[model samples]
Each structure stands twice: as C-alpha cells, then as structure tokens.
Target: MNPLYSPTAERADNRCEYCHAPELVFNDLFKVEHIVPVSHGGSDNTDNLALACRSCNKYKADFQTGTDPDTQTTTRLFHPRQDEWSQHFRYEEEIGEVQGRTPVGRATSDRLQMNRAAQIAARRLWMQLDLFP
Candidate 1:
C-alpha cells in the first residue's frame, strides 16, 4: 500500500476524490493517486494527492486534462483539493448518475468514465444501501 494511503483516504472521507465512490464497498483499498502525475512534473505533496477508485485511476492514468464533451475544449480534471464536489458535479439519485456542472467536472467525468454502465449499476446498488451520495 502507498504510505500516503491512510492519510489521503482519511482526508477524502474514504471516498474516491474524483468519482466520489465510497471505498467501503470495494475489497481493495482505494488508491492514493497523484492529482498531477510525477511524469507531468508533479510532486508528492499532500495537496497533489487524492484517493481514487480503481476505475478512475486506471482511466485517468497520467493525464491531467481531457476534452470536455460539452464544450469540445480541453480542460483540466477536477482537482480534489482545489475544487468543491458540489460546484463541479451533482449526483442524480433517480438515475444513479453523476452530472458535471463545469468544464473540469465534465472532462473528469468523461476521462474517468464515471457514468459507465457498470458504474451506474453499482451506484444504484450503493444508493439502495444508502452508501452513496
């Protein structure tokens, strides 16, 4: 496990900082990921780290920016430490989907594939269990 896992996870309230997926439902601990990858010249500073789910981490990889589906313009992914969840994204309970409210949110949602069918299915289940937002 990453040495920063405990503190990062705690700071994120045991949820993926990007997708807001609760860690409690997963068998594996959520990853402590770089908000900006080292390959992109990011440091290991706490502010640069975020807790991420397997899917989000995998999809995000080393990229920091993505094309906003709506604007068709490049935008940075949501910065957990700098951006507020409510300001960027909203959870639609009826559909178990997360809707982006800003460019960063939209790009992050698309880059991370947050609304994939599997994610929606799991979100619905988590909602039923009252474990999701």
Candidate 2:
C-alpha cells in the first residue's frame, strides 16, 4: 500500500463515502480515494483522502471534469475537499438518480457516473436494508 494511502476502513468510518454503505458488512473491497487525484496535482494528505467503493473509485479515475451526457456541456467535477456532497447532490429514491442542483454537482455526477445502473442497484439494496436515504 502507498504510505500516503490511509486505509479505507479508517478514512470513511468503514463506509463508502459516496453511497454510505458500510464496507465492513458489504463484502466488497474499498479503496482510498484522492479527492483531487495525484495526476491532477492533488496532494497525499488527510484532507484530500476519502473512502470509496471499488466501483465508484474505478468510475471516477483520473477525472477532474465531466460532460453532461444530457446537455453535452463540459463542467468541472465536484471537489470533495472544497465542496459539500449534499450541496451538490440529492438522492431521488423513486428514480434512484442523483440529481445535481448545480453545475459542479451535475458535472461530478456525470464524471463519476454516479447514476449508473449498478450503483442504483446497490443503493436500492442499501435502502431496503434501511442503510440509505
């Protein structure tokens, strides 16, 4: 493991930062994610680290910006270090889509592909377990 890498178990209170699923109980591997990726000149520091599930981490790899598939407009992704998740996204239970209230939110959702089918499925399961809102 990279010395700069804090264990996911420790970083996120054992939960996925994005979906809030308890990784200890989910049986899926978790990863230490850089809020700003190293490739983008992000530093390896506590403030820049977050815990993410393998799926979310992989989907978000190396992306600092995203194109809204709907509008075809390019926008910067949300910066976890500087932005609050709730400010950028809201979960819609009926549609299982993460609605973006701002450009940053929309871009982050698009870049991370946060509304992907698999994520929706997982979120549905988590909701069933009363683990998701």
Clashing pairs in 2: none
Model 1 residue 31 CA deviation (Å) reads 0.3
| Predicted model with the maximum TM-score | 1
Error of 2 at 87 (Å): 0.8
Best model per lDDT: 1
- Give the per-residue lDDT of model 1 (tens digit) for 1-133: 9999999999999999988899999999999899889999989999999999999999999999998999899999999989899999999889989989999989999999999999999999998889998
Error of model 2, residue 23, in angstroms: 2.2
